[model samples]
Target: MNTELPALILGGLAAGFAIFSIGLAAVIGPKRFNRAKLEPYECGIEPTPHAVGGGPGTAAGQRFPVKYYLTAMLFIIFDIEIVFLYPWAVHFDALGVFGLAAMALFVLNVSVAYAYEWRRGGLSWD
Candidate 1:
């Protein structure tokens, strides 16, 4: 329990500082607000001529390419898988052959999916 005391104190101080910052922002920040500020921001792109017509957020709204989503999902999947490797690496001696075999299979599975996506032009920019 003594070893945990420093961590607990550090955590409490960090949390308290976060709360203080939020409170300070609220108290000192501007209160002025307006329609433009309230409106959803497009990525610095000029609003389309058809914005007010068709429907709320109609086909006129900018359509992001699907490649963006696919690439993001692939990144998240591999990133999470790599994160799992860190803990296994930390406890490598204890986990032994079973952990080694399991990690190998995991890497193989992710690599296969990555190759498939690459072959399908999922990784390409049009």
Candidate 2:
């Protein structure tokens, strides 16, 4: 328990600071509200009222491209995989042949998925 004292103190400090910051924000932030400020923002554009006729301008159809989301998700997945690989690489000698083979298989799997996505136009800009 003595060994954990520093960790406990650090965690408690972090939690206390978080609560303090949130309380400060709540107390000091602006209270003025209006229709414009409350409306849903579109990047930097002002919110537009939906037209009477159902068309491409509808709220649902006005959504941004899905390609951006796919790209971001793929980046996050591969980035996390690389993070795991770095630790394994540093201990490669201790891990030996089995570790090397396992890492190789993992890399191969990642490569196959990347290639498949690439071939299927997942990364295409148009």
Candidate 3:
């Protein structure tokens, strides 16, 4: 009667199902090949050739700018802030001043990061 038995069983079933589905698809799926289908897609933008030694008929690839990852990380940071805020709000009465102080500190830290990003132009798309 291990407490973890149910979780382990559920995990095994999910993994088995995933593997079975993939195998089934490979066995029964139609094999279709075309130039357009083979080419890599980049958010509707035409793929560019590699920066070095990439010419005609070579594999096309491009390095995304650091700004793209930075923007994504910023979004995640703010989104996580909201996740923490919602639970704190729900338990505001029970937590009293301690929760209020903790949330204020958390908000201050997040705001500082936001202000820094804004000042450094990390928030700008261009």
Candidate 4:
């Protein structure tokens, strides 16, 4: 009759199902293999070389721009901030002024990082 027992049972069932599915796939899936199938793929499309890292005459494989990394980092920073904010917002009433002050500081810290990134041209695109 315990609420937590059902949750634990469900979690165990989910984990067991995942393991069973993986094993089933390995047994029932295609056994054939080749160089083409083993090679890395992106959206099933052949990758093209770019002029980012390699020079005009030099060759490149999956070369990416610096902006891509900067953008991904920025996304992660904001995403984590939102995750933290959601929990705090759900219990905002219980947290009171202390929670408000804590969140304000957290937001200010994130804002400073954002401003720093903005000033460093992390938001700029070529």
Q: Estimate each model's TM-score.
A: 0.58, 0.55, 0.56, 0.53
Top-down lDDT ranking: 4, 3, 1, 2
Candidate 2 clashing pairs, residues 3+ apart or interchain? none
Q: Write the per-residue lDDT of candidate 4 for residues 1-126, one digit (tens) a residue.
A: 697999999999999999999999999999999998888865434567554567667766455545666688889978888789998989999999999999999999989988998899888876
Off by over 4 Å in 1: 1-3, 9-64
lDDT scores in order: 0.82, 0.82, 0.83, 0.84
lDDT by residue for model 1 (61-123), tens:
555445666777878987887898898889999999999999899889888988998899877
Model 3: CA > 4 A from native: 1-40, 51-63
lDDT of 2 at 109: 90
**CA shift at 36, candidate 1, in angstroms?**
14
Better of 2 and 3 by TM-score: 3
Candidate 3 structure quality by residue, lDDT tens digits, 16-46: 9999999999999999989888878655555
The Cα RMSD in angstroms, rounded to one decimal, for candidate 4 relative to the true structure is: 6.4
Which of 1 and 3 is the better model by lDDT?
A: 3
Model 2 scores a C-alpha lDDT of 0.82
Model 2, runs deviating above 4 Å: 1-48, 51-64
**TM-score, model 4 to reference:** 0.53
Task: lDDT winner between 1 and 4, please give it.
Answer: 4
Which candidate would rank higher by TM-score, 2 or 4?
2
